[model samples]
Target: MNTFRLSKRIMNINRTEIADLIYNKIIENRSAIKTQFLKTNETVGYFFMDDLLPTELALEIHAKFPTTEEAVKRKNIREFKFTAFQMNNYNSLLEEVIYAFQDERIIQLISEICNLEAVYGDENLYAGGLSLMGKDNFLNPHLDNSHDKDRKRWRVLNLLYYVTPNWTLENGGNLEIWPEGLKKKQTTIESKFNRLVVMTTHQKSWHSVSKVLKDDVRCCVSNYYFSDTPFLNSDTFHITTFRGRSSEKIKDIFLRIDNGLRSNMRRLFKKGVRENPHQYKK
Candidate 1:
């Protein structure tokens, strides 16, 4: 059921109202979130907040989210999921909410809370926008690509807003952050409804999505914020590296070799053998 649809007038404005909601929520919770990030800053700093929007709005967004058939299926031993970045092809409300997070005020506020500088939003929605995972879908532990599409800026942070109502830890498709590496125990952050999780992205941040254990399809809105320099001084450029879980001993080794080969390829080719087709073409 289409629970709600933005009226013509609501879609024409700057979406300041939703942006204000995001800004206010983050402002009210800024201190605690800052402390939380600090607590884990030595490794992979991250913090999450629930009820990020009005409950009814979140549910309405979920209802309008595109089905798996309407998305781009990305499946392989490394990962299995559906992603959509061409925001114009979907509900306009989704695009509005997405760019709302990009609002100048919200970006500045996030910078203040996360102690970051020179941050900017991606209007192209590079490797972001929407994600959906269903039964058996999973993303192996990996570090995001270090830089933006053109290698002009460092990809510093990832924002994920989930809207699936009644989602639970048991349903899987949760964010797993491996602060230490694949050998160490990782942290699982549930992808609950109306929750927004912000995580620092750079070297030592190996994270993934657990396989969906149930038939439910998990939907998420994602964005990445880039900066003029690395969030961590020690960080360097690399491809989107992936590794199998520790249990998959052989797959892990294969992935390691693959990562190395791909890293070398990037050094030689600069832009890779081909362009990544994950960004908004327009």
Candidate 2:
């Protein structure tokens, strides 16, 4: 498929149309949305929306997602999932839809709803873009990295758009937000189709994904917004921190040690030993 034609057909100012749809939805429900975020932000700082986009459009985006073999696999204790940000490696439609969220209007509306200032979309897709979890894949509770790819701006918000049609709670692959800490019961957010979840990422905002129980895959388009200021006034810099569930005591100890070692390395080497190959080059 010609990249240009594919993008044109799928995106077709569809990027603008999607943004417009989101903007209008926000406008229509500004009071309710703001109230929801305000209440949740007091505890964990998060919000979610259902039927975020036209179901058919989201389904088309999901249909264009590359297979797990085409994405970078992270099969470590911290996580087991497939992610792809090298836009050229996938269909141009994927690239168009991903960048569409970066549109300024969408960014402004999101910032306003979240009561944030100076929020900026990441064009580089640092740790953003597309994510897939198949059977047994899971992400341990963790705090996102404190900054952008260059470590210049503070990572403040995480935007995840789930598009796997007919996904259910029993299917697993749901997002778990640890508002009070891992020892307490965490809030489980179902990864339903056409749902968009936005959460604040700070020093204490811990979150993870449940293991996929079924053979089917859970697909999502992700994006992060950064700002010049931290989400919390007391927020300090740190690497992406991970923690084991409450039941996994030994795993928790080991993960703490691992996080300590990585944090120390980042302290000595701002950019770490090597660059993270998770960004779009072009």
| Clash totals in order | 0, 1
Q: Against the hidden true structure, what lDDT does model 1 obtain? A: 0.90
Alpha-carbon lDDT, every model? 0.90, 0.89
Report the lDDT tens digits of candidate 1 across residue range 74-170: 9977899999889889988888888999999998888877889999999888889999999999999999999999999999999999999999999
Pairs of colliding residues, candidate 1: none
- Collision count of model 1: 0
In model 1, what lDDT does residue 8 have?
32
The TM-score values for the models, in the order shown, are 0.94, 0.95
Q: Which stretches of candidate 1 lie over 4 Å from their true place?
A: 1-14
157-269 in candidate 2: lDDT tens per residue?
Answer: 99999999999999999999999988899999999999889899999999999999999999999999999999999999999999999888999999999999999999899
All-Cα superposition RMSD per candidate: 2.9, 3.5
Residue range with the least summed lDDT across 10 consecutive positions in model 1: 1-10
